[model samples]
Target: MTIIITGGAGFIGSNFIFYMMKKYPDYRIICLDKLTYAGNLSTLAPVMGKPNFRFVKMDICDREAVYGLFEEKNPDVVVNFAAESHVDRSILNPEIFLETNIIGTSVLMDACRKYGIGRYHQVSTDEVYGDLPL
Candidate 1:
């Protein structure tokens, strides 16, 4: 099965990728990350060369690009870990947050509807819950 993991460069998302890779070696994993301040490409370095894994540097807010990805990947599942931060501060200026969190999520779901996906899981607010152990 192919699983498209959005925001896979962040700590929580990267951890999920590692866990999934280990748990399902046969699965095709497509990681889409915009590499914002919260996202670090180096975090996924360990799995970069894996045959079953692919990393795309793309923003979830970019509808055209996201749809292109959906076309290319034909993912069975889309786990949306993509989000924006500085919640309290950003609430004062929520454009970026809304674009990434709300609008971007809509784009993903629309693509899922057009392209067909078995599941779409949204994993959110690791920041609110506090950090998880690396």
Candidate 2:
């Protein structure tokens, strides 16, 4: 199985990549990350040389690039963790957050539909659920 993981260089995404690689040694893992401030390539260094691991540096909002990748990779599943996640930054410049978080997600979904990809998983934080009682 080939899985494309957007934002795979970020904290949670990177951890997921490591876990998947370890658990499914025969599966192909493609990491698509824009290398934003929160995305550290070094975090994925451990799996860099693995035969089943591949990395692509590109933004999820780039429709053409995303489509091309989907066409070439023919991934069975896409796990999206891409977003402008800093609360302060989102408060200061909401447009960027909207573009990345909303538009980027739309582009990814469109590609999935166009290519007939079966699974598209979104990894989101609890913040979207608003404040909750513990």
Candidate 3:
């Protein structure tokens, strides 16, 4: 089955891909990433062109591109990891966070709902739970 992993270039998402690759070598992995500041392609360089692994660079907030990918790839599952993950960065530019984290997620969710996708996974931060006491 094909699984689309958004932001698969980022830390947690990339690691999850590695884990899944090892666990289920038979499955195909489609990594969809925008390569935002927190996303580093280098993290996924090791598995860039495996027979079961593929990468696509696109912003989740872009409705046409997102829908196009869904149509073209026809992924069986979607794991959304695209977001403004850093709280410090969000503090500096709240607009970016709002646009990426809130609006982008909304767009992705809408696309998933419309497409009748099999599964949708949202990657969220513990930072939203509030800072840890020092």
Candidate 4:
């Protein structure tokens, strides 16, 4: 199976890629990322040279680029971990968050529909729950 993992350079996303690659050696994994503050390519260095692993630098908010990728790769699954984090950043610039979190997600979903991708998953942040009592 070919899976597209958005924000694969981020912490959790990277870990998921590592786990999936190890678990499914034959699966092709494509990583789409904008290389934002939360994303660092070096974090994925371990799998960078793997034949089944591919990293594409692209923003999820760009519909055309996203659609083009879907057409080219024909992914079977898309896992979205792309979103603006940090509560303070959200408070300071909510527009950016909306553009990425909502608009970007829509673009991915739309591409999924257009390309006939059957599975799509979103990895949400813990910030929604905020601090919790022990």
Candidate 5:
């Protein structure tokens, strides 16, 4: 199965990819990242040449490009992790956060739906749930 993971070069996303690739060698994993400050190819350098791994540098908010990728890749599953995950940054500039988290997510979902993706997953921040008392 082909799985598309957005923001796959980020912290959590990168770890998740590592886990998936280690656990299931049979599955194909495609990474879509905008290469923002948080997204780094270096994080995924270890897995770059694997036969089942592919990377695409593109913004999730770009509808045309996203749809084109879906058409070209025909991914069977999608995982949305493309978002401005830093709460401190969000507090300073909420617009970028909204565009990445809300608008970007919507566009990706639309593309997934159009391509008939069999499964969809979202990796969201716990900050959205508010801080918990320790």
Candidate 6:
């Protein structure tokens, strides 16, 4: 099986990539990361040379690039973890958050629909629940 993991260079996403790569040695894992402030490519160094693993640097909001990748890979599963996730930064500039988190997600889903994917999983942080007064 082939899986496309968006934001695979970020914290949570990187961990998932490691786990999946180890557990399923035969599965093809394509990592699509924009290399944002939150994303670190070094985190994925361990699996960089693995035959079943490949990395692609690009933003989820880029529809043409995303569509091209989907056509080339034709991944069976798409795990979306891409987002502008710094709470402090988001409070300062909410537009970027809206663009990456909302619009980017829509772009990914549209590509999935257009290119055909068996499954699409969205991974969101607990921050989505909003902060409660302490």
Best by lDDT: 4
Ranking by lDDT: 4, 2, 1, 6, 5, 3
lDDT by residue for model 5 (50-96), tens: 99999999999999999998999899999988878777898999898
Counting clashing residue pairs in each candidate, in order, gives 0, 0, 0, 0, 0, 0
Error (Å) of candidate 2 at residue 97 is: 0.7
Count residue pairs with overlapping backbones in model 1.
0
- How far residue 93's Cα lies from its native spot in candidate 3, in Å, is 1.0
lDDT of each prediction vs. the true structure? 0.90, 0.91, 0.85, 0.92, 0.89, 0.90
State candidate 4's TM-score. 0.92
- How far residue 68's Cα lies from its native spot in candidate 3, in Å, is 0.3
Residues 70-129 of candidate 4 have per-residue lDDT tens digits of 999999999999888887998888888878888898899899999999999987554422
| TM-score of candidate 5 to 2 decimals | 0.90
Using all chains and alpha carbons, the TM-scores for the candidates as numbered come to 0.90, 0.92, 0.89, 0.92, 0.90, 0.92
Clashes of 4: 0
Point out the worst 10-residue segment of candidate 2 by lDDT: 123-132
Q: lDDT of candidate 4 vs native?
A: 0.92
- Off-target runs (Cα >4 Å) in candidate 4 are 126-134
Model 6 regions lying over 4 Å from their true place: 126-134
Residue 57, model 2, lDDT: 99
Q: Give candidate 5 misplaced runs (Cα > 4 Å).
A: 126-134
Candidate 1 whole-model C-alpha lDDT, 0 to 1: 0.90
lDDT of 3 by residue, 6-38 (tens): 889999999999999999999899998999888
